[model samples]
Target: MTPADLTCTVLGAVRRAVEEGALGGAVAVPDRVKVERPRPGGSGDYATNAALRLAREARLPAREVAEVLSAELTRHPGIAGVEITGPGFLNITLAHGSRDALVRDTLTNILTSGSGYGQGRALSGQAVELRHRAEVRAAVTADAVRRLLEAQGALVRIDAYEDEAAGPVPAPTPAPGPAPTATLAYEPSPVPAGATAHELHRRFGTDATRWALLRAAAHDRPRLDDGLLVQKESNPFFLVRYAHARSRALVRAATRLGFTAGYEEDAAALGDHPALLAALGDHPAVLASAARLRAPDRVARHLETTAEAFLGFQHTVLPVGDEKPSAAHRSRLALAEAAGTVLAGGLSLLGISAPEYL
Candidate 1:
């Protein structure tokens, strides 16, 4: 299920629980439920602090509150095991096949619609204005987010990025022979070999503005972003990067697989250098938190789906194959490293760990 689906289901339960008067009105606040990954093998795929949150209001011990909610939540088909832990947390595990299917569904959605997928109607009447980087990196995935949202019918407005195009530089002549194609299986028309007209226009430059126009039209408001997107709510990419960076295997494997996933230059190459300190200078924590949430899908119902993506890259579903580690590959890998660095940096802003070797 998408994040919205989970929230809706949880809210429904909370609303009903409140109506049932089992624990009074205040204890049923679904928004209070905080979800995240349980330590490996910790009892569930997704864990929530819902019980603990309602403990005081319900005038019961945290564990007792947890037990009550666990029983109530299980009535929903999607929820499998609901274990009580620590003081009074609810560690929820979705049914077995659910995760696998969720992943397949996400991949199918992403592949079929690409940037256009996941655009929703719930947000049809709403609007979000975004402040994105100018001449954005072709490798950057946030560009896809606007499309995903629009695909779902939500109105999205993107602020104009700087006009100057930071067209990717021609990598020094790449190795002659075609590098590996054994590992090719992802999205957004991978960057093609250089010397082109499309290269002249920044993808961010075009798409961001295009998205803004669509957002204004969809939401029926021009200044919606100024009012809606809000102050520093943050790019959802932060969440994606967080998960990948935190997953030791995901990070290391992504490094090897050339998933150079960063917002700037490759992570390894940019380390502790005197130059970059200025580039990253003073980015805020709120922006960092959103980035650190492990791609926002983390251990939630969406994790099974997210994990599969990493697996695909790790296993060479799109193999680097035998392309002699060409300049293209190096540049691409550096891009991936940039992603890792950005993800880790995002988490650090949120007070989370973005391990280096992992």
Candidate 2:
């Protein structure tokens, strides 16, 4: 099951607990239950503080509420065990056999949904007017805002001062001079002096330039330097794109090896790598939050997290020399591909290109 599914399972358990008088009928089910990866030294695929949240309403100790809900949750399929710890947290471990299936299904969903996977109608039926001055930074910011707003089903109209119609005025004419010979010359657009956007674009091209522009808080001045062009770990843009390209390369290599991603019993190895799973599962929430907050940097940062997780999981995805392809390898590969989809989709929202080859 995906993390979202597990959340619903926990929510249901709480509701059932309430109805069955386990926690008494006075406690109300929360509108939403937060399920997240456990902290370091915690033993679980995911954890929830539902018991803590409902403790006051139930007029019971947090641990008591956790125990009641834990009992109900442990009975559910796909959940191997549930632990109530430290004042009332539910640490849940998925059944070993279910982890592989969950990874397989997650990847399948990502592939089928393509770039539209994390899209939502949170701003549906809303009309938004984004107004900005004619400055380069403002214009670029507005464009990014337009894409993000539109992604959430908002009807966005960008009104820039530069695009407005000019009032009637006398036109200036150049002094008469000798006619010059006809010649074609390509002159690039002019950019403001000391403006990083244009300079970065000229040096690093479109994707990197846009990323540098939108990856910072809108109120903060973007750092536009050769630093962004660096092809190292310090450069998040490179890391995100490189991660995506690496995933694509793995798929190609797997195809040549006469195997494709599939579910396997031994694929439970994916569960052992919680970082990657957590990042993939959190993708939808990141996208929605970015759109709601009108901040593309959230998506950019999320891509970095996803990239790091994938890099850590990379060695496990493919076999070493002479080692034959196995079901576990295929499942791990599927997880890798899902990470790529998330990276690409998030980059698209940020108006950055996720190249198949970096």
- TM-score for all predictions? 0.39, 0.80
Residues 176-225, candidate 2, lDDT per residue (tens digit)? Answer: 23332332221111232246444556787778777776777766667678
* Number of the top-ranking candidate, with TM-score as the measure: 2
lDDT of each: 0.40, 0.75
- Which candidate number maximizes lDDT? 2
Q: Write model 1 residue lDDT over 71-185, tens digit each, in one string.
A: 7888888777788778876787766455444433433343344222222343344344434444322222233333333333334444434442232322222223333233211
Displacement of the residue 165 alpha carbon in candidate 2, Å: 16
